[model samples]
Target: MQKKTIAVGNSSFIALIEDQHYYVDKTACFKPLLDSGNFIDLITRPRRFGKTLFMDSLRLFLAINPANPGSTAKQERLFNGLKVREDKNFCDKYMGQVPVLFLSLKGVEGSSFEAAYRALVQKIVDAAKMHAYLLDSPRLDEEDKKLLREYQSRDFMRDLANIDYASSFLKNMLFFLARHFDRQAMLFLDEYDVPLAKAASRGYYNAMCDFVRAFFDTLKPEAGLVLNDRPVLKKAVLTGCLRVSKESIFTGVNNFSINTICSDNVSLSACMGFTESDVLALLDYYGLSSRKQDVKHWYDGYRFGSNDIYSPWDVLNFCQCALSSKNPLEFKPDNYWIGTSSNDVIDEFLGFLTEEDAERMQTLIDGGSIELQINDELNHSDIRRHQSEDFWTLLLFTGYLTIAKHAGYKKYLLRIPNEEIRNTFRSRVQVRFSVENRSFAAHGLKLAEAATRGDVGGMAKVLEPLLKNYVSVRDTATKAPAENYYHGFLSALFACAGNRINDFQSNAESGYGFADIVFSSGYGTDRLGIVIEIKRTARPEELLDAVDNALKQIDEKNYAECLRRMRCRKYYAYGIAFCGKNCEVGGGTLREV
Candidate 1:
């Protein structure tokens, strides 16, 4: 099969189609949304789940080109071969029939309220420029034209940044478009809650809220509206990661409909992410059908409504990487989703971790689910409180956690979604433990020191307490070998030494085998090296035997040959074994290379 070009980061609908990039046909979602008859709709999904791309497709499908109002030839070509084009009646009635005001608040963020308010107004100016032709439309009065010109100017945008001036901005923009097109405008507000989330994180929530609440209130219909007495908007759809409560942002707005991860509407739920069939078809097209199970293990645990979905971003990225590899079958899957955005929210949430929460988190890391009251509608302020429910809710919406099942009213079982997200949790937990308890780092360095001095009992003393108190891994749900987890824990502990250790290597090839860890520290004559081998057992009684076996392997396999190669005059080799939290340590006498 021929490979279609995977546009890994292209979110524009027109660009994806015109550039001939591999496009997932989500155009089918357009019909239901248009036929719902609801004046306003809010759809929330996790970040990078293709929400932006979905909204762009909707905009391009419905928007009447300001430059050529009489023709949709360009859009017709764009939608060609897509699933929605199959519906002739739907296409004839709605496609390219409406004026669309597409505004994204995703980039409306700053360190302070003033700066963020400036960004918001700048976005308004950018949106208005798209309709600069409205200034020349004979249907608009001179006063409306003057306002449009002012909105498109940077000088006027500076003045409009204030809450009082910006409050009526959207209403007036819709009115101008309505007059130009002789029809009420459709509004697509993407990432609508981004400003508020940024504001909350930066300690300016109230000021931003005052502006957002007033700005969004324009969606409501008023009895005194002119222009044939039609409401300013024919329809409005807002896409965001979290659904801010109606009482907060959408105050007084009637006929509002929300589709979230927990929504009962299966169609709406499947709209944002790739369904199983979508993934299978994409993989088959890319000739990666053999790797379907590997692909699912990393990125396919997200549950949206009644459908199981995969992260479109991750799947496309994985496919792109696989196709680029010499042997696609041997290409290992990676955590592509975590690197796209800040995992600081997870870090912040983990900072408030208590003893009970840590245990619960470990259970989640072990592939087990925990019951929590899930609230899909949460504002940044609710997240700021660090309540358990709020944190988990944020996690669910942000794609770190997924719903395993519903337990009771408002209660649901949540687990780390897949291997990619589980790895994120594990790394974050390690950092959280290292940062929150400064003594943990001290103990970690001391453990290394003990291992370097061939003091087996000292190494065991430090390892046992840490393994018991701070380790986040156990018999994971995937049933991966326990040795890898123990190896990771020891590597993380040694990693905390930072600059003190000159070099640290994990699973580096040595004389005859791959050593679990080999590191060199100090300088000149004082330079020293340490070699470690980690093992895990199911029963405490087997810990000593595991430790002895590890020691034998380190010697027979010449794990310390790596230390000698690193030019360390003196080196120490040790073996550590773990059964749950308890551990045993063994080592040979310190030796010179």
Candidate 2:
């Protein structure tokens, strides 16, 4: 049994098959797609959810060899042993029998409208070159061949005047292929909305939207015609992260069907992501079955149309690390999904948070949920308006949040999907709110003053109010203990406090053990040092006991060793215990080192 290689970032179906990379069979999605009556299908999922792979696989499965039309041998070998191979009759009807045009808009992004338009034209020319054999067809006249030849040349692609025909490039290509094969072509466009998304972020949204609208005009029924008055487009599938409204770019295409994460279409639900069984089998194949719980905790909470799915990107990267490690079991789960993109969506979303919205954000980070109306079809322009409805909708569709449960008509209880996403939210929340620390600087200063004076009760009073208002990380039994959450909160608080606090260190070395927090402040003989230990209690009744034990630990471990080096005449060692938003603080008597 040879080990199968994991394709970390590869999306090429043919290459993956030829190279024998481990793959989860999503070919079963083909049967439903064929049975679907819609002329154009738009499937939306978050980025890095295997949308590109699925589209590329579909392209090879249906595409005929343009140079050698009688070649099913190549297609057959590529799909061998996959689930779609089991459907012999269906495969015989459709496989290797049609001209397929596949285009990806993932790279069609730019800082300006002109730049983005040029990129799109390049994409059109690239797709045209894929089926260059159409130039040799006897059914096509010299004029059609001349047009394709122009499309293949570098001069036509670089001509700024050709921008006018950019929207119709694919349409003309479909016509040329249809005239040659005497069969309508199927179109598969991947990352269809990337240009609009990039344009919106770069402030050229309207210009890009108009261009996309014209490009989508090719999907209209009237535009799908060839020389013999036959429809050139038999079926089309477009993949993107969001469903831009029909009024925005996809105007008047009645046959356009959408399958989003929230849609009830069960067929495409498991296609874009890996199901539990898919992940389990992958783990077992690599002898990492013991890591099932860790994998599920970090990557598995996405609910796509009533089916639980794990991010395929996260799963593959995790498996790659485990397989390369000497001790797979000791490998800890990581936030693999965060590095896939710029995470600008989360940043833009946090920028619009009102104080009221901040409370809702707190709820989500604390392992709870917030209810809101989710609009699956949102225009790019709406995001510019900073509409709360649009922001929440974007968050849900972009994978920052998932539906815990459907509430009323369009309302949903949305929450952070898993530990990986939750961690992202917590870190972002800390950064976003810390910028507005001036709002609570008074409380932070009071807490600092209390800590310097050994006033434990006063410190608790200051933190209690701040805790009630601030966003908190999840503190469930399955998660890292709440102590870490409190530690970050206090660290941020002390950092923002006035000049009274200095040389702050968190979880730094002390006497015989690591101290949760150590700092020195004041000057000359009035210079003082402080050491703090933090704890979280399961029940409120144990708050005082937890505080007592924390103080005892500090004393036993001589946490004041760092303060002694700081040359402080005296120091205070305080113990803090938090139970939910409430807390208890106690400290040993101030003493000379």
Candidate 3:
């Protein structure tokens, strides 16, 4: 494959196109959103899923100045040959035709509302500089000009940074932009909840909430004789990972529309992430046709309004690494997206981990689905509260998990989305809670190393703690015990080893039928190919019987045939049984569950 540039972070769309980066054209989303009747929109999607990129694109597209020939021509050239260009009529009608007031509160981070509020002020300062040409506009009255200058003034910002003034300040600013440009303006708030989330982490939720709440109320300013009037913003769109409730952010704002992953909104469903076709176009261009299925398995399970989408950032990160890696083998689909800013909220969530939290996590990790009361309406403080509802909802919103199906009546089935996210969850559990002991990965590796050497006692050491702490009692959605839970527990351990083991699999074909688990050592795999059969019974008294039954089944089914097929120098078979938290193991040399 020839070399290709790829965007890794917050680079410009124009830069991505002009620099010849591998671009996925999601321009089809532009027109539908532009035409959507809702005047104010709140689009909630996980971070790094291209929310900022899409917002930036929207800002640039609508920031199109029809009267300014140079600016219009530049935007047209930037979008030339893109998916949007195919619809010339739509492009002609809407591209850069109005004023845009774009504000991103993403990077405003601090311990107190005061510090974080100042960071927000800096964004306004930057916006003022971008629109400084408005000062010379004949349309601006002396009053509007003074209002703009006052906002730009550092002293004014400092005075306003500490109260409700900071919240309603943007409303006045938008009014100024409207008057200055002689046009109603579209407003974009990128990472709108970031400051609130930061404040929640810092224990300033109330102060932050008071400020943010009043600020959002600006979108619904009353007008006319009754004074209960419409906001001046022609159209407003806000993007964030989680949806803070209308009761909080939009308090009195009417006719507000939210396009979240859980929504059936057609236009916005495919808006946030790159669709499968987009991914295919990218892979075909890069001559990675052979790895299509690999990418699909790892990055492509997210479903939004019947549209399957892949994380554009994850796809780009992997493709970039692939393009740069001299050896093809180095381009493994490890969780490259994890170490990015994806897990900061997870770390915040970690501080509140309890035993119940560990159990629920294990249940999800064990390939079991969790049913939680789905409340897409949430606030930043909700995540830090001691509530299971908050934990599951936050996980679903933040991309570690996704909705499997709506169970109806405010309940949703949630699971680890795909291999990429599954690996991420496993790694997180081991890394974060491995405190006071060997990190989770170390213990799993020690067990993997022992299993390779056929050390039953060492495997016991690894299996015991895992069952008690990380393994859940219930199995699948069906609530069966033996099969899914044990299978999930073993799969999770191997997954924690990461690339240490090759072909570490569950319910994979072998011998006469399928084996519960099997793998050969390579990265962390043992030279001996191993197959395991698992049995579950409710009676701890029958643990021995369960183990024996599992062993007999393993032999009768010839589950070890998969190992023989591998032609490994040696092979090991294991029959494991679990009854409650109790376990028994039986195999070629050692017996336990």
Candidate 4:
């Protein structure tokens, strides 16, 4: 089957139509938005979920004729056969009827706050360039002409001083647009939070936040300002990933109707990710209906509000791969989402996980859920300074994990959404852990051998030195920064033995509950199995008690039941306790002492 050309990163609604690219008609979104009457809406969604494309759709729908300012003939063909055509009233009311102030801050990336700000300023300048006709409009007065001509000034790029003083691009652009069109302007901002997220990761969050807020501050009425002096922004729409608490970015703006995955309103849920109908239609179109369940198990687990939506990007990429395969079953799912973007959230947060956090992650990775307090509103700074459930909130916001169950208000039982994210967790841990000293990684063999015979003391000695350097000492277990460091290190050790690590499960089901870490030597009468329970203690004095408790839990839980059922020759269960730089290992056969 020949695959239709996918608009992977193409954000142009017009281009998608003109080039006949494969697209899901999200123009239905234009109605609820029109009915809401809320203009300054910030629709937050994870990356590659059609936010940018939607922004483009809205721009084309509202934009005055770019080729002929007095007429909208050219833009009319762009929406041919789209969903918006069903609503004759909406089409007559909005299609290319208003002046548009469009700006996309998605490409703004830099090392420092100033550099990023410069790039953002450049984007603003380019948006003004898109409306160069505003300057030539006979309706514009001299004051507006001065403002529009300032945009054409080449020296503005080098003049950071002027940009710093008067840099509300949205405000100035809207002002000029309103005057030129002799009516209020509709503003469209795509990936509005991209700069904020990038700045947070780059250590310029506060500065970027201030700039962002300052820019938005112009959108509202200021003190000592009359109706005439107010911002020209009428119905403005912005799209990005994080909502970033009202106290953080949208501090003063209360008019915003934010639609996130957790929102009570399900109207925009289908608008974010591809809905079930969308997946079904695409599969049928591509002649891959037989593999629907397989595709669902892989790329279709994300929950937005109350709707289940597949990642449009992943689904398209899956089709791209499936088109090359002779059979749908032959094409396996991979981390298609992570492949196109940086895993900054995963990579950065892994370094801060506490013993408990890492343990929870292990459980989630092994197809389990962990309870967490989730705040739908979050900032990038919260991610860095946070030691609590906010980490899960950020991950959920970014689509790495989804709500497995909502326990209560601001509380959720989260788990990895599908095989793609699960593989990412495994791969990231492997990279972060296996890159340490070769000698330390080599110790995994010795550690594995000791576990085979349940040499508790020997295993403790091998891990003690490694923990001293790798363990992050949190006064409590709620936040373990070095949780992944040691867990990954230990896993890497077992992994060093070639295919032997294939039998390892960090939290595998066995007796009644689950085992912390288990290693089985395959199904053989002579083979041996190893079970280890890990516990973290805040004080060295508690190490012994912790080890004792772990061993008792292992016994009580019957963690070796699975291996025993497999008819293994014998299996060993060991208890390991960690306290800062000290550790005490226990449990083994009666003779191993």
Candidate 5:
């Protein structure tokens, strides 16, 4: 494979440049659409998934007919030997008979729905004028001529009241063009839900939803009149990230079909870019076979239904890096997917944190699943009702989290995609969790450090302060329960010190039952394991009994099986009993056996 210049930031360049290898032949995606001859279809795919490139490919293929009036002879040369060239039926029936109204809604990010809706309509109107220029027909009725002039004027608000009504203006314009050309008008909408995502995240979901609902209403059956010998509206293909389910936004559209990530009808994965064979061949040409598995691990888990999809954006970036560098690992890790959204939205969602939620989050961090119940109507108004799974789903769809697996039907278990997300989440959680319990964290840190070093005196010094300040309260009204404080203190300790010296497991399965805290660390040539038992009382005899019970459980359950499997030179299990933060270390004596 020859090294091709990967084009960036230019939509036109992606479609027309084949000699320079700037274009990948994804014309295979047009097969189903062209075969079925559907007038309108909506496709929902994540951002940077080649929606723009696919639309541009369609534009080039349609720009070649004499009936279309803008047939550039040079543009016809661009599609030679492409997938569409082999389709005899497509060439005869649809190659150049219709005029296409192509528009992208990707650039309309706004502070509110009204502002964004206005910007979106302006873009569509501008696209209409550009198409009109391509048509170059001076002959028109007064009403058609007026519509064209009004479109050029760009005061779409006067022509249409709301975003929904705005689509009527577009439909009318397309209707007129089809009649003028004596052909059906084909509509290709790219990144159509961008405005909706922006508005929903910026506090205008309902307004945005209403606008989109009205906009799509124009495509309803018998909504517009046919003009000249042309069909008023012939076909449309709309693509975006979220499906915005018809029950949610697009109502009353009886003939439309949705091509989504989970759709059985569309092979959206291969529609975007290169196939697996293409990737392997490229790797072999570039001598990157060794790094192929690593690349797949990071970017290959995206599943569009059962057909696993790879991010075309990442694949391109990787190819560019491979061509430019001798070192295959030179590409820097980046959260490229999440960079499209504002950080404030992520921060705002993280702001609603509680201690219980923190504990649950820790379990998830350690590879546990969280269940979230979904309701009938899921909208921005009920955003706060979102459970952990809802937030995880949002993160997954938005690219913060990647779907690890589909657990049954609707349940999607999620995990951080790469080290970038993992590290970012870890830092954010540390700051938030530490802010509310600075002093407690400090005290717990001291105790954990001493326990790691096996210094009984140093541990007592820290334990005394915790008992006095937090655990010494006898009146239930004045303080939290002793058990609650113990759990919290242990959690803070594990969080702050576990990464450094101790391997602690909270609510992890042990021999007979789950253990509260099992701290293990290695010394010069030996290993030490401590099983901590927390209770409400600190009597000497009671402490001894608790310690004996913990040791017996450890023996019964083979809790040290992990250490033994690792073939440690030595091991010891110490049981420490705690009451209201005060603890005494007494357990079965350390023996070589």
Candidate 6:
């Protein structure tokens, strides 16, 4: 693979140009969105899926329009010969037509609610000042200017009284700029839901919602009137991970239209990042076609609509890793997506999860679907139900997930989209639930002994506790605990074994059937293989019968196909039976041939 030329993060502009990493062309994704002459369309996407970059590209495009004599035509040079320019009609119709108001609500990591609200307002004011400059309006009188300066000088606490009216100030600013510019203003608000998310996690959601409602109220009716009169106020485009519903913020704004992940009118999916062709080109460029399957399995399954998509951030990061490592396996996945958001929210949610919820979570993890409601209210108290096949759907819609499929909805399946998200979720789950140490140490030790000595009885003894503690009774209407319980036991055993006896895998397919567990010793010298079978028996004699049945199945199914393929000299197989917490272990009783 060739050396990578781009770094992935919010600091792409600074790093992409300065660093020597090769960057792929992602400008094509934004072409249709930018070229289309739509106004007031909101695009919602999951976090770290390139929402910020899309907005940044738009900002760059509009700031450099050639129609405005004062605009920096030189800045327009950055986009010359790009995909947007390919559409001659769009370029002529929309290019350089109006001034753009781009603002991001992402930097509100305040120490307190009041402080954060103040900081958020200040960001708007700062952006407004840029608009003021662009409009060059003398609408502010001397007294008004003095008041604005005085308001800016006060501390957050001292300014709290006037903070309730901060929206009016911003509204007035937008109105003044529209009148001054003599053209409709296009507002691009990026990460518009940050404050709500921050407040929700902090238990200050009410305050944040109130502030936002007031803030948005200033933009509507009043701003609409100004735009109607001035013709300069064109449209607004808001992008965020979550769409705070109108009922939640702009309660009475009947003119508003929301283009969310579910919206069919807006093709926002393509705007956020590259498609499959983009990834193939990059992979081909790097001469890493040999690892194409691995790349697809690990990072290639995000779909946002009718089109299959990949997270641009993950693709870039993968490219950078492949370029640096001759072996793709050496590349460590980073949880870039989850790292972008505050962990407190996810941690809190996980902490409150009930056992039933955890079981449901497993189903979601195992590609099962569940119904969830989307509330349009401020508090998310109302529920609008939708069927989702996996947790990936919930994760993507809630910013924890991303598009893994783009065909019709039936073809989509969501996983932890990239290395970044997988790592983040792993870390959060560990931190939040690691304290609940269920006593599996004794069981783990016995299981290890059984594997070492090929003692089926010892294995049964250890697995008995697992069956009692983890498995649900048949009376319960739960899905069969095949993969979930087995995997859990394996993980617990590995953890308790002090990481010494590694190289364990389960569900190895054989000619006749599949083996439940096949654990091998990590040490090359003390080689061992152990096969385990689990059963629920009605009587003590049934335990022996279960063992006999397992042994027959093992041979009939050719469970040793893999071992035979490797030409191993000797192999160990054990059969185990469980009746609730009780178990019996014994050797395989070969059939008399």
Instruction: Please name the candidate that would achieve the greatest lDDT relative to the true structure.
Output: 2
The CA lDDT of each predicted structure is: 0.81, 0.83, 0.72, 0.73, 0.60, 0.57
* Best-first order by TM-score: 2, 1, 4, 3, 5, 6
In the order shown, what is each candidate's alpha-carbon RMSD?
13.6, 14.9, 16.7, 15.7, 17.7, 17.3
Off by over 4 Å in 2: 434-593
lDDT of 4 by residue, 301-348 (tens): 888888888988888888878777777667776678767667655544
Cα misplacement distance, residue 252 of candidate 4 (Å): 2.3
- Candidate 3 off by > 4 Å: 1-4, 66-71, 160-165, 221-231, 342-360, 430-593
Q: After TM-score superposition, what is the CA distance of residue 248 in candidate 1 from its true location, in Å?
A: 1.4
Candidate 6's residue-wise lDDT over 243-360, tens digit each? 6667678766644666555455435556666677777877776776665666666565555656666767677777677667867655655444544554433432343334554554
Q: Model 1, 1-593: lDDT tens per residue?
A: 55569998788998888777899899898988989989899999888888899999999999897888878897788988888999999988888889888998988987677778889888988888888888789988898888888788867777643456577778888888888888878889999999988888666899899888888877877621457777868889999989999888777888899998877786688898899999999998888999999989999998988999998989999999988999998899988876887765555555444666766777888899998898767888887676777877888888888989988888889988899888887776545644455455556667766766678888878887777676654343247777877787788777655444657999899989999999986555557888878887878999889888888898899887877767798887777888777888887477775
User: Candidate 3: what lDDT?
Assistant: 0.72
How many pairs of residues collide in each model? 0, 0, 16, 4, 5, 31
List, residue by residue over 1-593, the lDDT tens digit for candidate 2.
89889999899988888898998999999989977989999999998999999999998998988777778988789998899999999899888998888899998876567777778777877877877777878988998888888777766866777766676777888888788888888888899999988888666898888878877787888766655677898889999999988888877787888999888789889989999999999999999999999999999999999799998999999999987888888898888876777655544455445676777877888899898988777876677676778878988888889989988898889999899999877665445544375356546666888898888888988888877778453443336656888888888778755455777999979889999999986665667899899999888899999999999999899988888778788999899998878889998478887
The residue pairs that clash in candidate 4, if any, are 352-481, 353-480, 354-479, 354-480
How do all models score by TM-score? Answer: 0.73, 0.73, 0.69, 0.71, 0.64, 0.62
How far off is residue 303 in model 2, in Å?
0.2
Candidate 6: misplaced stretches above 4 Å? 1-4, 11-39, 64-72, 128-158, 222-228, 326-340, 351-356, 367-394, 399-593
Give the per-residue lDDT digits (tens) of candidate 5, residues 137-229.
Answer: 654567667666666666755344533446566577677667666677777888877777676655577877776776666576566566654
Which is the better candidate, 1 or 3, if ranked by TM-score?
A: 1
Model 2 residue 55 lDDT? 95
Among all windows of 10 consecutive residues in model 3, the one with the lowest summed lDDT is: 223-232
In candidate 5, the residue pairs with backbone N, CA or C atoms under 3 Å apart (3 or more residues apart, or in different chains) clash, namely 39-235, 39-236, 164-214, 164-215, 511-557
Looking at model 2, which ten-residue stretch has the lowest summed lDDT?
471-480
lDDT (tens digit, per residue) of candidate 3 on 531-562:
67788777778877877887677778777666
